[model samples]
Target: MGIVRNGHEASDRWSYIRRFLGGVAGIADDFLGWWWRGKDTLSPAELAAAHEQWADRAEWRLAQRAEELASDRIKRYLVTSWTDSVAYTSRRLAAQARGELSEWIPQRERRPDLHTEARAIFADILTELNIQSQPTKEQSSVVHLRKAG
Candidate 1:
Protein backbone atom coordinates (compact mmCIF):
# COMPACT_ATOMS: atom_id res chain seq x y z
CA MET A 1 0.00 0.00 0.00
CA GLY A 2 2.77 2.39 0.87
CA ILE A 3 4.66 1.61 -2.34
CA VAL A 4 1.57 1.82 -4.55
CA ARG A 5 0.17 5.04 -3.17
CA ASN A 6 -1.58 7.46 -5.56
CA GLY A 7 0.49 10.30 -7.11
CA HIS A 8 3.65 8.47 -6.01
CA GLU A 9 4.34 6.87 -9.42
CA ALA A 10 3.13 9.97 -11.21
CA SER A 11 5.56 12.15 -9.30
CA ASP A 12 8.48 9.73 -9.38
CA ARG A 13 8.30 8.73 -13.02
CA TRP A 14 8.57 10.87 -16.10
CA SER A 15 6.25 8.80 -18.30
CA TYR A 16 6.71 11.17 -21.21
CA ILE A 17 10.35 10.08 -21.61
CA ARG A 18 9.23 6.59 -22.63
CA ARG A 19 7.96 8.01 -25.89
CA PHE A 20 11.44 8.90 -27.07
CA LEU A 21 13.07 5.54 -26.29
CA GLY A 22 14.17 3.59 -29.37
CA GLY A 23 17.05 2.36 -31.60
CA VAL A 24 17.23 5.87 -33.01
CA ALA A 25 20.49 6.63 -31.20
CA GLY A 26 23.77 5.02 -30.12
CA ILE A 27 25.26 3.77 -26.85
CA ALA A 28 23.30 6.04 -24.52
CA ASP A 29 20.02 5.15 -26.21
CA ASP A 30 20.90 1.45 -26.09
CA PHE A 31 21.68 1.72 -22.40
CA LEU A 32 18.36 3.43 -21.80
CA GLY A 33 16.51 0.71 -23.72
CA TRP A 34 18.23 -1.93 -21.61
CA TRP A 35 17.32 -0.09 -18.41
CA TRP A 36 13.62 0.13 -19.36
CA ARG A 37 11.43 -2.90 -18.70
CA GLY A 38 8.27 -4.48 -20.19
CA LYS A 39 6.00 -2.02 -18.47
CA ASP A 40 8.10 0.92 -19.70
CA THR A 41 7.61 0.01 -23.34
CA LEU A 42 7.60 2.71 -25.99
CA SER A 43 4.34 3.32 -27.87
CA PRO A 44 3.99 4.41 -31.52
CA ALA A 45 1.72 7.38 -30.72
CA GLU A 46 4.09 8.54 -28.00
CA LEU A 47 7.06 8.24 -30.36
CA ALA A 48 5.46 10.68 -32.76
CA ALA A 49 4.66 12.97 -29.86
CA ALA A 50 8.27 12.76 -28.71
CA HIS A 51 9.46 13.89 -32.11
CA GLU A 52 7.04 16.81 -32.06
CA GLN A 53 7.72 17.65 -28.42
CA TRP A 54 11.50 17.44 -28.14
CA ALA A 55 13.45 16.33 -31.21
CA ASP A 56 12.20 19.09 -33.49
CA ARG A 57 12.85 21.74 -30.88
CA ALA A 58 16.35 20.37 -30.27
CA GLU A 59 17.29 20.88 -33.94
CA TRP A 60 15.80 24.38 -33.90
CA ARG A 61 17.67 25.23 -30.71
CA LEU A 62 20.96 24.12 -32.27
CA ALA A 63 20.47 26.43 -35.24
CA GLN A 64 19.31 29.30 -33.02
CA ARG A 65 22.35 28.95 -30.76
CA ALA A 66 24.71 28.89 -33.75
CA GLU A 67 23.16 32.12 -35.01
CA GLU A 68 23.44 33.80 -31.60
CA LEU A 69 27.12 32.89 -31.31
CA ALA A 70 27.82 34.07 -34.86
CA SER A 71 26.26 37.48 -34.10
CA ASP A 72 28.42 37.77 -30.97
CA ARG A 73 31.76 36.42 -32.29
CA ILE A 74 33.61 35.20 -35.38
CA LYS A 75 33.12 31.83 -37.11
CA ARG A 76 36.29 30.53 -35.42
CA TYR A 77 34.47 30.65 -32.10
CA LEU A 78 31.93 28.21 -33.57
CA VAL A 79 34.70 26.02 -34.98
CA THR A 80 36.42 26.04 -31.59
CA SER A 81 33.23 24.72 -29.98
CA TRP A 82 33.16 21.78 -32.43
CA THR A 83 36.88 21.06 -31.87
CA ASP A 84 36.41 21.20 -28.10
CA SER A 85 33.65 18.57 -28.26
CA VAL A 86 35.80 16.30 -30.45
CA ALA A 87 38.85 16.68 -28.22
CA TYR A 88 36.87 16.18 -25.01
CA THR A 89 35.19 13.04 -26.38
CA SER A 90 38.52 11.58 -27.48
CA ARG A 91 40.15 12.27 -24.10
CA ARG A 92 37.19 10.81 -22.19
CA LEU A 93 37.13 7.65 -24.36
CA ALA A 94 40.87 7.14 -23.88
CA ALA A 95 40.70 7.69 -20.11
CA GLN A 96 37.72 5.37 -19.78
CA ALA A 97 39.43 2.63 -21.80
CA ARG A 98 42.52 2.88 -19.57
CA GLY A 99 40.24 2.19 -16.55
CA GLU A 100 42.22 4.81 -14.58
CA LEU A 101 39.35 7.31 -14.58
CA SER A 102 38.31 6.37 -11.06
CA GLU A 103 41.84 6.83 -9.79
CA TRP A 104 41.74 10.56 -10.60
CA ILE A 105 37.97 11.14 -10.51
CA PRO A 106 35.88 10.83 -7.37
CA GLN A 107 32.21 9.86 -7.88
CA ARG A 108 31.03 12.81 -5.78
CA GLU A 109 33.25 15.32 -7.61
CA ARG A 110 32.50 13.93 -11.10
CA ARG A 111 30.76 16.91 -12.65
CA PRO A 112 33.23 19.53 -11.49
CA ASP A 113 36.14 17.25 -12.35
CA LEU A 114 34.87 16.78 -15.92
CA HIS A 115 34.31 20.50 -16.30
CA THR A 116 37.89 21.16 -15.16
CA GLU A 117 39.15 18.56 -17.61
CA ALA A 118 37.32 20.15 -20.54
CA ARG A 119 38.42 23.65 -19.52
CA ALA A 120 42.07 22.59 -19.40
CA ILE A 121 41.76 21.05 -22.89
CA PHE A 122 40.18 24.21 -24.24
CA ALA A 123 42.87 26.37 -22.64
CA ASP A 124 45.58 24.22 -24.22
CA ILE A 125 44.04 24.67 -27.69
CA LEU A 126 43.69 28.43 -27.13
CA THR A 127 47.37 28.58 -26.22
CA GLU A 128 48.28 26.60 -29.30
CA LEU A 129 46.31 29.02 -31.47
CA ASN A 130 48.23 31.91 -29.83
CA ILE A 131 44.91 33.76 -29.59
CA GLN A 132 45.55 35.27 -26.18
CA SER A 133 48.72 37.02 -27.34
CA GLN A 134 47.00 39.04 -30.08
CA PRO A 135 45.40 42.39 -29.34
CA THR A 136 42.07 43.51 -30.80
CA LYS A 137 42.07 46.44 -33.20
CA GLU A 138 40.04 49.58 -32.62
CA GLN A 139 37.27 50.51 -35.02
CA SER A 140 38.68 53.97 -35.50
CA SER A 141 42.40 54.76 -35.64
CA VAL A 142 44.57 57.35 -37.42
CA VAL A 143 48.35 57.47 -37.98
CA HIS A 144 49.92 60.88 -37.36
CA LEU A 145 53.22 61.77 -39.02
CA ARG A 146 55.42 64.52 -37.49
CA LYS A 147 56.87 67.11 -39.93
CA ALA A 148 60.61 67.94 -39.46
CA GLY A 149 61.99 71.40 -40.44
Candidate 2:
Protein backbone atom coordinates (compact mmCIF):
# COMPACT_ATOMS: atom_id res chain seq x y z
CA MET A 1 0.00 0.00 0.00
CA GLY A 2 1.10 3.56 -0.75
CA ILE A 3 -0.06 6.98 0.20
CA VAL A 4 -0.88 9.72 -2.28
CA ARG A 5 -0.42 13.20 -0.96
CA ASN A 6 -1.73 16.28 -2.62
CA GLY A 7 0.65 19.13 -1.89
CA HIS A 8 -1.15 21.55 -4.10
CA GLU A 9 -4.66 20.22 -4.16
CA ALA A 10 -5.99 23.34 -5.85
CA SER A 11 -9.24 21.90 -4.59
CA ASP A 12 -8.92 19.06 -7.06
CA ARG A 13 -11.79 16.67 -7.31
CA TRP A 14 -10.73 13.13 -6.40
CA SER A 15 -12.32 10.17 -4.67
CA TYR A 16 -10.46 7.38 -2.85
CA ILE A 17 -11.74 3.94 -3.71
CA ARG A 18 -10.00 0.56 -3.50
CA ARG A 19 -10.52 -2.77 -5.21
CA PHE A 20 -8.94 -6.23 -4.80
CA LEU A 21 -8.73 -6.55 -8.61
CA GLY A 22 -7.57 -10.18 -8.76
CA GLY A 23 -8.23 -10.15 -12.55
CA VAL A 24 -4.51 -9.70 -13.21
CA ALA A 25 -3.83 -13.01 -11.47
CA GLY A 26 -6.80 -14.59 -13.36
CA ILE A 27 -8.42 -15.06 -9.93
CA ALA A 28 -11.11 -12.45 -9.52
CA ASP A 29 -11.30 -13.25 -5.80
CA ASP A 30 -8.41 -14.16 -3.53
CA PHE A 31 -6.93 -13.38 -0.13
CA LEU A 32 -3.90 -11.66 -1.56
CA GLY A 33 -5.63 -8.54 -2.66
CA TRP A 34 -4.23 -6.49 -5.51
CA TRP A 35 -5.43 -3.50 -3.57
CA TRP A 36 -5.29 -0.17 -5.25
CA ARG A 37 -7.22 2.99 -4.60
CA GLY A 38 -8.43 5.02 -7.51
CA LYS A 39 -11.27 7.12 -8.77
CA ASP A 40 -12.30 4.15 -10.88
CA THR A 41 -11.38 0.57 -11.76
CA LEU A 42 -9.28 -0.28 -14.79
CA SER A 43 -10.52 -1.98 -17.96
CA PRO A 44 -9.64 -5.68 -18.18
CA ALA A 45 -7.02 -5.25 -20.92
CA GLU A 46 -5.46 -2.29 -19.17
CA LEU A 47 -5.31 -4.19 -15.88
CA ALA A 48 -3.51 -7.09 -17.56
CA ALA A 49 -1.01 -4.75 -19.20
CA ALA A 50 -0.35 -3.04 -15.89
CA HIS A 51 0.25 -6.40 -14.20
CA GLU A 52 2.77 -7.41 -16.90
CA GLN A 53 4.68 -4.16 -16.50
CA TRP A 54 4.62 -4.37 -12.70
CA ALA A 55 5.81 -7.98 -12.73
CA ASP A 56 8.74 -7.14 -14.98
CA ARG A 57 9.79 -4.35 -12.67
CA ALA A 58 9.42 -6.59 -9.63
CA GLU A 59 11.69 -9.22 -11.20
CA TRP A 60 14.30 -6.62 -12.00
CA ARG A 61 14.13 -5.32 -8.47
CA LEU A 62 14.71 -8.81 -7.08
CA ALA A 63 17.72 -9.38 -9.35
CA GLN A 64 19.25 -6.07 -8.38
CA ARG A 65 18.66 -6.73 -4.70
CA ALA A 66 20.30 -10.14 -4.90
CA GLU A 67 23.39 -8.69 -6.54
CA GLU A 68 23.64 -5.95 -3.95
CA LEU A 69 23.21 -8.20 -0.92
CA ALA A 70 24.91 -11.48 -1.85
CA SER A 71 28.69 -11.86 -1.73
CA ASP A 72 30.62 -12.16 -5.00
CA ARG A 73 31.27 -15.85 -4.38
CA ILE A 74 27.61 -16.50 -3.56
CA LYS A 75 26.60 -14.49 -6.62
CA ARG A 76 28.86 -16.56 -8.88
CA TYR A 77 27.48 -19.78 -7.42
CA LEU A 78 23.92 -18.54 -7.96
CA VAL A 79 24.67 -17.60 -11.56
CA THR A 80 26.11 -21.06 -12.22
CA SER A 81 23.20 -22.80 -10.54
CA TRP A 82 20.57 -20.80 -12.43
CA THR A 83 22.31 -21.38 -15.78
CA ASP A 84 22.64 -25.10 -15.09
CA SER A 85 18.97 -25.39 -14.15
CA VAL A 86 17.89 -23.69 -17.38
CA ALA A 87 19.86 -26.25 -19.41
CA TYR A 88 18.10 -29.13 -17.57
CA THR A 89 20.87 -31.54 -18.58
CA SER A 90 19.07 -34.66 -17.36
CA ARG A 91 16.01 -33.78 -19.43
CA ARG A 92 18.17 -32.95 -22.42
CA LEU A 93 19.84 -36.37 -22.26
CA ALA A 94 16.48 -38.06 -21.75
CA ALA A 95 15.08 -36.28 -24.79
CA GLN A 96 18.07 -37.40 -26.89
CA ALA A 97 17.33 -40.98 -25.95
CA ARG A 98 13.48 -41.06 -25.71
CA GLY A 99 12.59 -38.04 -27.86
CA GLU A 100 9.99 -36.82 -25.39
CA LEU A 101 8.82 -33.30 -26.31
CA SER A 102 7.86 -32.52 -22.73
CA GLU A 103 11.50 -32.94 -21.68
CA TRP A 104 12.26 -29.54 -23.19
CA ILE A 105 10.33 -27.81 -20.43
CA PRO A 106 12.11 -27.41 -17.11
CA GLN A 107 10.54 -29.19 -14.15
CA ARG A 108 11.07 -28.89 -10.43
CA GLU A 109 11.18 -32.54 -9.47
CA ARG A 110 11.09 -32.07 -5.68
CA ARG A 111 11.25 -28.88 -3.71
CA PRO A 112 10.24 -27.76 -0.23
CA ASP A 113 8.13 -25.08 -1.82
CA LEU A 114 6.42 -26.67 -4.80
CA HIS A 115 4.81 -23.83 -6.73
CA THR A 116 7.13 -21.01 -5.55
CA GLU A 117 10.89 -21.13 -5.91
CA ALA A 118 11.02 -17.52 -4.79
CA ARG A 119 9.73 -18.46 -1.36
CA ALA A 120 12.41 -21.09 -0.93
CA ILE A 121 15.17 -18.80 -2.17
CA PHE A 122 13.98 -15.94 -0.02
CA ALA A 123 14.23 -18.10 3.07
CA ASP A 124 17.62 -19.52 2.03
CA ILE A 125 19.10 -16.12 1.32
CA LEU A 126 17.87 -14.69 4.58
CA THR A 127 19.40 -17.57 6.50
CA GLU A 128 22.73 -17.28 4.70
CA LEU A 129 22.85 -13.53 5.18
CA ASN A 130 21.81 -13.77 8.86
CA ILE A 131 18.91 -11.41 8.18
CA GLN A 132 15.20 -11.93 8.52
CA SER A 133 13.98 -9.72 5.70
CA GLN A 134 14.72 -6.47 4.00
CA PRO A 135 12.08 -3.97 3.08
CA THR A 136 12.24 -2.64 -0.46
CA LYS A 137 13.51 0.90 -0.75
CA GLU A 138 11.10 1.65 -3.53
CA GLN A 139 7.47 2.33 -2.79
CA SER A 140 4.88 -0.27 -3.68
CA SER A 141 3.35 0.07 -7.13
CA VAL A 142 0.11 1.35 -5.77
CA VAL A 143 -2.17 1.62 -8.78
CA HIS A 144 -4.05 4.81 -9.17
CA LEU A 145 -6.72 6.19 -11.43
CA ARG A 146 -4.00 7.73 -13.61
CA LYS A 147 -1.58 4.76 -13.60
CA ALA A 148 -4.35 2.32 -14.53
CA GLY A 149 -7.52 3.92 -15.72
Candidate 3:
Protein backbone atom coordinates (compact mmCIF):
# COMPACT_ATOMS: atom_id res chain seq x y z
CA MET A 1 0.00 0.00 0.00
CA GLY A 2 1.39 3.38 -1.05
CA ILE A 3 0.24 6.87 -1.71
CA VAL A 4 -0.90 7.87 -5.18
CA ARG A 5 0.51 11.25 -6.19
CA ASN A 6 -1.64 12.92 -8.76
CA GLY A 7 -0.95 16.37 -10.22
CA HIS A 8 -2.57 17.67 -7.04
CA GLU A 9 -2.07 16.77 -3.35
CA ALA A 10 -1.52 13.73 -1.04
CA SER A 11 -4.47 14.22 1.31
CA ASP A 12 -6.35 11.34 -0.33
CA ARG A 13 -7.98 13.85 -2.63
CA TRP A 14 -6.20 12.82 -5.85
CA SER A 15 -3.25 10.79 -4.66
CA TYR A 16 -2.87 7.25 -5.93
CA ILE A 17 -3.05 4.31 -3.56
CA ARG A 18 -1.49 0.92 -4.08
CA ARG A 19 -3.23 -2.36 -3.55
CA PHE A 20 -2.11 -6.01 -3.28
CA LEU A 21 -4.51 -8.84 -3.87
CA GLY A 22 -4.85 -12.54 -4.76
CA GLY A 23 -2.59 -14.55 -2.49
CA VAL A 24 -4.86 -17.53 -3.04
CA ALA A 25 -4.06 -17.84 -6.73
CA GLY A 26 -0.34 -18.21 -6.08
CA ILE A 27 -0.91 -20.61 -3.17
CA ALA A 28 -3.35 -22.83 -5.06
CA ASP A 29 -1.04 -23.31 -8.02
CA ASP A 30 1.67 -24.63 -5.70
CA PHE A 31 -0.67 -26.91 -3.77
CA LEU A 32 -2.37 -28.42 -6.82
CA GLY A 33 0.90 -29.28 -8.59
CA TRP A 34 2.38 -30.81 -5.45
CA TRP A 35 -0.69 -32.97 -5.00
CA TRP A 36 -0.60 -34.37 -8.57
CA ARG A 37 2.91 -35.32 -9.55
CA GLY A 38 3.57 -38.63 -11.29
CA LYS A 39 0.67 -38.98 -13.72
CA ASP A 40 1.60 -39.36 -17.38
CA THR A 41 -1.65 -39.49 -19.32
CA LEU A 42 -0.50 -38.52 -22.79
CA SER A 43 2.47 -38.18 -25.15
CA PRO A 44 4.69 -35.08 -25.11
CA ALA A 45 3.92 -34.15 -28.70
CA GLU A 46 0.18 -34.36 -28.14
CA LEU A 47 0.53 -32.28 -24.99
CA ALA A 48 2.44 -29.62 -26.91
CA ALA A 49 -0.30 -29.42 -29.53
CA ALA A 50 -3.01 -29.03 -26.91
CA HIS A 51 -1.01 -26.31 -25.22
CA GLU A 52 -0.70 -24.46 -28.53
CA GLN A 53 -4.43 -24.70 -29.01
CA TRP A 54 -5.11 -23.37 -25.51
CA ALA A 55 -2.72 -20.47 -26.12
CA ASP A 56 -4.51 -19.57 -29.32
CA ARG A 57 -7.87 -19.57 -27.61
CA ALA A 58 -6.58 -17.48 -24.70
CA GLU A 59 -4.89 -14.93 -26.97
CA TRP A 60 -8.01 -14.40 -29.06
CA ARG A 61 -10.23 -13.91 -26.07
CA LEU A 62 -7.78 -11.52 -24.42
CA ALA A 63 -7.49 -9.44 -27.57
CA GLN A 64 -11.24 -9.15 -27.69
CA ARG A 65 -11.44 -7.96 -24.10
CA ALA A 66 -8.69 -5.43 -24.69
CA GLU A 67 -10.65 -4.02 -27.60
CA GLU A 68 -13.78 -3.72 -25.47
CA LEU A 69 -11.93 -1.69 -22.83
CA ALA A 70 -10.02 0.47 -25.27
CA SER A 71 -11.72 3.72 -24.22
CA ASP A 72 -10.03 3.66 -20.82
CA ARG A 73 -6.25 3.56 -21.07
CA ILE A 74 -5.74 2.61 -17.44
CA LYS A 75 -8.41 -0.05 -17.68
CA ARG A 76 -6.82 -1.22 -20.88
CA TYR A 77 -3.52 -1.72 -19.08
CA LEU A 78 -5.20 -3.90 -16.49
CA VAL A 79 -7.19 -5.83 -19.06
CA THR A 80 -4.11 -6.27 -21.19
CA SER A 81 -2.28 -7.76 -18.23
CA TRP A 82 -5.17 -10.09 -17.61
CA THR A 83 -5.34 -11.12 -21.26
CA ASP A 84 -1.60 -11.67 -21.46
CA SER A 85 -1.82 -13.81 -18.37
CA VAL A 86 -4.59 -15.98 -19.86
CA ALA A 87 -2.52 -16.40 -23.00
CA TYR A 88 0.55 -17.35 -21.00
CA THR A 89 -1.30 -19.80 -18.79
CA SER A 90 -3.18 -21.20 -21.75
CA ARG A 91 0.10 -21.96 -23.47
CA ARG A 92 1.28 -23.90 -20.46
CA LEU A 93 -2.04 -25.62 -19.90
CA ALA A 94 -1.99 -26.62 -23.53
CA ALA A 95 1.29 -28.38 -22.79
CA GLN A 96 -0.27 -30.07 -19.81
CA ALA A 97 -3.25 -31.06 -21.90
CA ARG A 98 -0.90 -32.94 -24.24
CA GLY A 99 0.77 -34.59 -21.21
CA GLU A 100 4.14 -33.31 -22.35
CA LEU A 101 4.52 -31.56 -18.99
CA SER A 102 3.86 -32.74 -15.48
CA GLU A 103 0.97 -31.14 -13.62
CA TRP A 104 3.16 -30.64 -10.53
CA ILE A 105 6.31 -29.24 -12.09
CA PRO A 106 7.41 -25.80 -10.78
CA GLN A 107 6.60 -23.93 -13.98
CA ARG A 108 3.38 -25.80 -14.43
CA GLU A 109 2.29 -25.28 -10.85
CA ARG A 110 3.16 -21.60 -10.66
CA ARG A 111 0.31 -20.60 -12.96
CA PRO A 112 -1.18 -18.35 -10.30
CA ASP A 113 1.98 -16.26 -10.24
CA LEU A 114 1.25 -15.16 -13.77
CA HIS A 115 -2.17 -13.97 -12.64
CA THR A 116 -0.78 -12.30 -9.55
CA GLU A 117 1.78 -10.42 -11.61
CA ALA A 118 -0.93 -9.31 -13.98
CA ARG A 119 -3.04 -8.03 -11.10
CA ALA A 120 -0.09 -6.16 -9.71
CA ILE A 121 0.49 -4.55 -13.08
CA PHE A 122 -3.17 -3.72 -13.31
CA ALA A 123 -3.45 -2.31 -9.79
CA ASP A 124 -3.54 1.23 -11.06
CA ILE A 125 -6.26 0.41 -13.50
CA LEU A 126 -8.29 -1.25 -10.81
CA THR A 127 -7.92 1.77 -8.58
CA GLU A 128 -9.05 4.08 -11.35
CA LEU A 129 -12.12 1.92 -11.78
CA ASN A 130 -12.85 2.19 -8.01
CA ILE A 131 -12.83 -1.57 -7.57
CA GLN A 132 -12.04 -2.81 -4.08
CA SER A 133 -11.85 -6.06 -2.20
CA GLN A 134 -14.32 -4.69 0.30
CA PRO A 135 -16.74 -1.79 0.54
CA THR A 136 -15.39 1.33 2.20
CA LYS A 137 -17.12 3.29 4.99
CA GLU A 138 -16.49 6.57 3.21
CA GLN A 139 -19.94 6.64 1.69
CA SER A 140 -21.66 5.89 4.99
CA SER A 141 -19.48 8.40 6.74
CA VAL A 142 -20.66 11.08 4.42
CA VAL A 143 -24.27 10.14 5.03
CA HIS A 144 -23.70 10.17 8.77
CA LEU A 145 -22.21 13.61 8.61
CA ARG A 146 -25.13 14.84 6.58
CA LYS A 147 -27.62 13.47 9.11
CA ALA A 148 -25.76 15.04 12.03
CA GLY A 149 -26.28 18.43 10.39
In model 2, the Cα lDDT at residue 79 comes to 48
lDDT of 1 at 29: 24
* Of candidates 3 and 2, the better by lDDT: 3
Best by TM-score: 3
List model 2 lDDT by residue over 35-83, tens digit each: 3342126454444433443333333334545655476644544544553
Q: How many angstroms is residue 44 displaced in model 1 relative to the true structure, after the best TM-score fit?
A: 3.3
TM-score of each: 0.23, 0.27, 0.35
Error of 1 at 78 (Å): 8.2
Better of 2 and 3 by TM-score: 3
- Window of ten residues with lowest summed lDDT in model 3: 13-22
lDDT of 3 at 65: 60
Clashing pairs in 2: none
Using TM-score, rank the candidates from best to worst: 3, 2, 1
Report the CA-based lDDT of candidate 2 relative to the real structure.
0.39
Q: Rate the local accuracy (lDDT) of all candidates.
A: 0.40, 0.39, 0.47
